[model samples]
Target: MSKLALDAAVFSDAAVAPDTRLVNDAIVKALRALGERWAAPLPEIRAARLSGTGTFPLPPESPRARVETIPGPRGPVPVRILMPDGAPKGVYLHIHGGGWTVGSARENEGLTSRIAANCGLAVVSVDYALAPEEPYPAGPDDCEAAALWLVNEGPARFGTQRFAIGGESGGATLAAATLRRLRDRHGLSPFAAAVLTSGCFDLRLTPSVRNWGELPLVLNTEDIARFVGNYLRLEGRADDPDVSPLLASLKGMPRALFTVGTRDPLLDDTLFMANAWLAAGNATELDVYAGGCHVFIGFPGTITDQALKRIDAFLTGF
Candidate 1:
């Protein structure tokens, strides 16, 4: 059964790893140090200079479809739309993960293109404004606007009735928040499904947050706290369901495919959200990679090959 498969996936990493506890401790220490350095608020001038770094390499000869700029409250937001060479099955709006503070559509172009090519779907990768500059609601708002534009325009532009939303890390958070906003504000559910990978669903740290501190993964509690601090101006708002979709009521949302690595600090957040969705009578599928780290699914041809395969399979079904 699928449940048994999921359990095996969750535990497989533990079965192979030796001295996981010791490895976790060293990971925590290294992450703490990185957190301290990244905590320094860079000037807008300096941040812009470093913006292009850490981006994923683009695929060679991947044809660029059309680049569109939509007006955001602050300014025009650039979105890279990638289309398959042939007719597409559906469309997907992708948000790239970077803890809500770093990373951009450019950095994730390769992954987005790969998804489009493999899934036979048109992908619109949005470059939303980052935090410490735009802050809460701004980033999420930009995403909502982009999604709205797509729903309103995609029918004529792409000739597709079915649509989906997806993202990893902070991008995943935006996707979930955008879904909630669309339901509440527009009274429309345009997406056929959604994919959330290693999402930080709960802004208010939970028990799982503490456990992530003990994992040897790329993301740590300290980095997350710093991300939260940059994204949320008011501390009390951290628990608001709009900011933290895990706390939101999961009624009338799209069917979801949740992915996470066992070593990812956000593993529990993904599990909690998926369980909540299922309990709410919504269809939910989960793929947990044992010993996989945060955003590992983005690393194509790497340890995350199986995870990406599962995603392709899930999206194809939709």
Candidate 2:
């Protein structure tokens, strides 16, 4: 059976192994815990700022991470580089998600470092500018600058021109926008693959975001609005492809693996983007995990384990 057909069995969790499940009871409890933490009502736009989630404890300081300040269109952008070993097979550019507000490159150390260590890829994670202060174009501009630097200097520095880009939540929006900028303006096709996870593709609040308000999500409709509002305060339009990648042309973009959960508020974003990619005659794979809230791949457990394994497999092919 094709992978799509296999999904039926995987989701059912009957004829498949333990690591893969569409819905697990543990995920439900995890979601509920998160809901309780965010029990306070949404803050006003002016008063809104990302809640204190503390930096993820730094991973083992091995393989040594290099923090560098690169000149971006908006002056400077910080990037974290993690290389597992010498002579990496490829370089992976990872963009982090925190509603374009409260996340840093080290937030993805657990994921990016593993990818670098096991997959023989150098992982470059961008610390893009946050919104409400920098907003819209600043985030995309920084990401674009990072991509441009990688394409120009990566081969000489990392010894590999083969690269892929991916992001989650707000970062995914920036990643997709960066890819479009690379393709449309620079005539670049350096990405061998793309991975978008639980991304908000539409800034106008797509139907999924509109309907998932009462649902217990790490990101719900109200939070979505606040993030988008903060981002657009400067100049991004809701329908502009850069702000809403779903509205962008997917033509000539690299093959992508799109992941989202059934209960995720951004479910429709992934579905819509995946369909558009396939419709544009590009390779696409869509995986929908049942009962999962927004961006569960980073969450520790069986589901994250399987998702990372899946990510590793996808990179092997690229």
Candidate 3:
């Protein structure tokens, strides 16, 4: 593959980090080798690669962790709960990212545990339904149910009513949609803050997503298109506010932190959504990390540490 090239202005607002680019380059090489080794289709390969059953061992889960089920719009939604050292002051609902196809609540226990411990809050991670099997409404519906349950039942269970929501990649999109659903359907906006990382807020691909050719930056144009197709299943659903939060009314939404890497295909999504969130009278913070790729937070590096610090500060403030 060719080396990545972008206008210097493209990363004008990005953090000056040094290790993300190298880490992402290594990831790209591994991905290419995996594709060559596997004979399955791209979707199957991707699903298997991200299914939380791969060879990679995730960061360890917190000692104070448990799994439980709560009532959802469709049925019982399983959630992984992590608690801090003492009685919590608030609750944080975390959504896992996997392009709406693969991933589980247990997959991100390490991150959730850190959030729980650092923020002095109970962390609940949702294991929502996936696409090509469960599809768009299923994932969103499950997330909405989790949020509603947290709003209505969390205090009784965790001793606090304060709430925050966040997710990565497709999960971030679902988190945004869930917030909108709460605002419009239930006439509620109870979240203290939102952290959206590398979310594809617009189903209709942005210029960066559409124009990003095959460069070994973790995700190319085709990969994103495939993920969107799997999630939506049919065409013409891109404009719905539920499907694309960028097209939704951001008024009454919680204070949000939009994060993305300059090398990610969804860079424009963060850029555009942050502006829209601010313009719609909501407080918004944008963080662009130079040379970081899609889901760069998963890679341990200086940028990831900085981003987590920023996220911890953002959430702890509320």
Point out where model 2 deviates above 4 Å: 1-63
Ranking by TM-score: 3, 1, 2
Tens-place lDDT per residue, model 1, 126-227, is: 989878777887899899999988888898888987899999999999999999999998998999899888998998876667756633356777778878
Candidate 2: what lDDT?
A: 0.78
* Residue 14 C-alpha lDDT in model 2: 50
Residue 280 C-alpha lDDT in model 3? 84
Q: Quote each prediction's TM-score.
A: 0.86, 0.85, 0.90
The candidate that wins on TM-score is 3
RMSD in angstroms, all models? 3.8, 4.3, 5.0
Q: What is the RMSD of candidate 3? A: 5.0
**164 in model 3: Cα distance from truth in Å?**
0.5
- What TM-score number comes out for model 3? 0.90
Q: Which candidate achieves the best lDDT against the true structure?
A: 3
Total clashing residue pairs per candidate?
0, 0, 0
